[model samples]
Structures are given as C-alpha cells and as structure tokens.
Target: MALDRWIALVFVTFCCAYGYLAFATMDQLLPPFMQRNPVWPSTFPKVLAILGVIVGLVVLFGLEKPDSQSEPSATDINYRRLHEYKLGQALMLLGLMALYALSLRPMGFLLSTTVFLMAGSAILGERRWVIMFAVSAVAAGSVWYLVQQVLGIFLRPLPFFLGG
Candidate 1:
C-alpha cells in the first residue's frame, strides 16, 4: 500500500510487458541478416527489462532500508543558499553541445571538437587559454586521426572553403 510498493508494481508490470513485446517483435523489427547474429538487436531492450524487473522486485519487497540521516528535515530546506554557479555551468555546457551539433558538419569534426573542448574547459574555470587550446587541438586531432586512419570510419569532411 506504500508509495514505493505501488511504484515498484507499476514498474514490474511495464517491464514485463515491454520484454514480452520486444521478444515477440524481434523478427519483424530486425533485418534478415541482422537476425542471424548471436546478439540480436532486441538484446539490449530485453536485458534492460530483466534488470528493471529485478530492481522492481527488490523495491516491492523492501530489501533496502531507508537512511534516516540522509533525509532532509523541513527546517533544513533553504532556497536562498542554492548554488547558481553549478546550474549556470550546466546550462552553458548544454548550449555548447547544441552549438557543436549544429556546426559539426560544416566545421568538420576536428575543428568543432577542438572549439567545444576549449569552450568547455574555459567554462569549467580553466585560466590558461593557450594551453587549453593546445590540449584541445591535440585531443581532437588524435581522435580524428584514429577514427579516420586506424578505424577506417570517415568523419564529415571540412567545408569546400577549408579544403575538404
């Protein structure tokens, strides 16, 4: 009758249904060639469903004890002391990600990744711009080279103006 028990019951039901559907529709969802593989495409979903069922059973049975010391009291709740810097940094990082995604194809992987790393380091309070840029360049170039040359995975080419 407790909230945790109710949540667990719902979670178990959903996971069971999801697992059943995933297994039932595996053949239809996957290509014929893909179905030949030992690890089917539905494997991840089925695994997650099983894990979810286990977690739900644990929660429903109340296997874990609630820690009283970690619980916040009514008096301990203070809105004024909230850390703004952490929130601001998180928002900035998200914005940078969006910008990077938008510019990636046009700017190429190496250039976009370098800029993203430099911006992320600066936002995280790194002071030395020169060193940050150098590190960013090296890291980005290494990943690009490894993926393109060693792994044979081609990235988006640079724009025509930049000599793709």
Candidate 2:
C-alpha cells in the first residue's frame, strides 16, 4: 500500500478506537457539570472520529490517479523525499507528546510542558540552547499562569514529594 493509504488506515483505526473509548467512558471521564451540559462530553470525540473515518475513506478511494503526462518529475521526487523527512519528524513529535501526556500529572503542567516544549524544539532542529530554553520557559510559564491563575482552572497536583 502507498504511504498515504497506510496513513489513512492508521488514522481511521486510531480515531475509531479513541471515539469508542471516549463514548464508552464519558461518564467516568467527564465532570458531573460537563456531563449535564447541553453540548455533551462525548460529542467532540465522536465528531472527530467520524471526520477522521470520512477523510480516511476519501484518501483511500476518492483521489484521481495522475495521468502519464503528470508523472512525478525530479522536483516532485525531491519534494516527496523532503515531505517524508518531515513526516518522520512529525511522528517523533507525536511520540513525545504522548510521553508528555503520560507524565503531566506526576511532573505537573509547568515542568512537563516546559520539557515538552524544549524537547520538541530540539527535535524540530533548533540548535540554540539559550533561545530554546527561554522560549520554552516563557511559553510554559505563561500557559500555567493563565490556566491556573487567570482562568481559575485547576491542574493535576504534582507528586507529593514535589511540594505540590
């Protein structure tokens, strides 16, 4: 199968699974207030899953084949190679995001987000440590301050040993 087809298949499978889990566990996952809200907690996940499946199906079956005259040229090949490189980078970033999600409660939003930002910048080929750290720290701190202070939103408590 082509890489695009494979990507579509993976997207469909992931979305379906995510949607199912979200639907099945909505009561447990959502706060009581959110569950009682008009929009409903499972709506977004269900919509995302449906859209993902629709897009996947279209990608798999709807695209028109290129004519012989439109065959890939040298420039197209180079662009495709570059795209593949970027795709690999994107996958790595996704893995890092998953790791950050898993670590968030234990590490706290400030620490986990800071690390995630710093590591993500490095993975995307940023070489200057000072600028990277500064940007990451500022972004993380700003988000933390906004969410916790301005918005009065509560985050998961840091581990007991960390003075949460």
Candidate 3:
C-alpha cells in the first residue's frame, strides 16, 4: 500500500506493455542478412523492457523497512514557495522544444539538438558560453554518431543545404 510499491507496480506494467508493443509491431520482412541476425530493430527496446521489469520487481519486493532519514534538513528550502515556480522559464523551455521539433528536418539532428541543448541550458541560467557550446556540440555529435554510425540508423547530421 506504500507509495514505492505503487510506483514499482506501475513501472512493471509499463514495461510489460512496452515489450508487447515492440513484439506486436515488429517488421515482418527484412534483407536476408538482417533477417538471419539475432539483433533486430526492436532488440534494444525489448531488452530495456525486460531490464525495467526486473528492476521494478526487485524494488517491489526488496524493501525491508522505511528509513526516516529522508526528512528535509534545515538547509532545505521551504516547499510553501509556490509563487517562485518560475512559470516563465518553464514556458520558454516548452516553446524551445516546439521550435526544435519543427526545425529538426531542415536543420538536421546534429545542429538542432546542439542548438536546443545550448538554448535550454541558457534559459535554465547557465552563464558560461564556451562550456555551454562545447558541451552541447559534443553531446549532440556523440549521440548522432552512436545512433547513425554505430547502430546503423539513419540520422541527418547536417542541414539540407549541407546534404544531410
């Protein structure tokens, strides 16, 4: 009846549903090479579902006792400051996400994701320009490389003009 149990049960149910979706939607036809391979497009997602189910079951059954040390300390801010929710910042981030989604095809994954990361960080109050640019570019490039090159997925990394 505890909150953690509820969360774990929800997690397990979600994982089961996810795994079913992967199985039900799997492609029926593939090139001869790919058809014979053990790793399909859904392999990773199904593996994630399995892992999630295991972790959720462990959490659901492993708890011995609730710890009282989770109580907030003196340095913690009071939760009554709902007026400082920074609604403007949240709205800006949402707008930025919408722009990123719209720009993905034209700007390509690498450029759009890098810009999104930098803009999101700036909107969240990161002041160091060089660090923001470097981190965003590296993270975006790394993900693009992994998804496109390593996983054999197609992702346009450059703008349309650049032959993405």
Best candidate (score: TM-score): 1
Alpha carbon lDDT at 76, candidate 1: 41
Tens-place lDDT per residue, model 3, 1-164, is 54567788999999999989877776455567897788899889889999999999987784543556576455434456536778799999999999999999999999999999999999999999999999999999999999999999998899999999
- Which scores greater on TM-score, model 1 or model 2? 1
lDDT of 3 at 72: 44
Across residues 1-164, which tens digit of lDDT does each residue of candidate 1 receive?
Answer: 55668889999999999999877876587877887899987889989999999999998887764566565454442445557337899899999999999988889998899999999999999999999999999999899889999999988656556876
Ranking by lDDT: 3, 1, 2
The alpha-carbon lDDT assigned to residue 17 of candidate 1 equals: 97
Cα deviation at 4, candidate 3, in Å, is: 4.3
Global lDDT scores for all candidate models: 0.85, 0.79, 0.87
Higher TM-score: candidate 1 or 3?
A: 1
Residue 127 accuracy (lDDT) in model 2 = 94
Q: Residue 110's C-alpha lDDT in candidate 2?
A: 78
Q: Which stretches in model 2 have alpha-carbon errors above 4 Å? A: 13-42, 64-69, 73-95, 156-162
All candidates: TM-score = 0.67, 0.62, 0.54
TM-score, structure 3 vs. true: 0.54
Candidate 2 lDDT by residue in tens digits, 92-139: 999999999999988888788888999999999999999999999899
Ranking according to TM-score, highest score first: 1, 2, 3
